[model samples]
Target: MTAKLWIDSDVCMSSGRCVADLPRVFRFDDEEIAELVPDADIDAEFDAHRDLLVAAVRNCPAGAIHLQEDGVEVEA
Candidate 1:
């Protein structure tokens, strides 16, 4: 019913692209890892900045970003 983004902790290389791209939706912890806010709406959480999310995933380098919709994984 809605869109979502998942970050693979293991694959994340701490590039901080997610946080820089979608600061409202993602945050960097002390360890420089990206953390997604729980229960946060994909639209609202990222301030309707879908491009930023897309860019983050595309430039992830680590291939840790996963986009999904309604419980189904969606290709970037």
Candidate 2:
């Protein structure tokens, strides 16, 4: 199944990796912290690019990105 995604803004380091690597799923907020693109269909993205999403979560330097499936957090 598709996973749910979010970012912990407080922990975000503004590295821009996710935004640069997956613009369709992520973007920088006004303060420059990475966040999920508001209009993105997360389910569709998870279904289509699960590996990339997992990589994003794993690669986030600040460990700010999160993902869940069936309400259980997905570990990087």
Checking candidate 1 for backbone clashes, the offending pairs are: none
lDDT of candidate 1 over 6-56, digit per residue (tens): 898888899877777667778876788888866567856445666677677
lDDT of 2 by residue, 1-76 (tens): 7578999999999999999889999999899989888999989988888888889999999999999977889886
Give residue 23's error in model 2 in angstroms. Answer: 0.3
**Alpha carbon lDDT of each predicted model:** 0.75, 0.91
- Candidate 1 yields a Cα-based lDDT of 0.75
Name the TM-score of candidate 1: 0.75
> Per-prediction TM-score, please?
0.75, 0.94
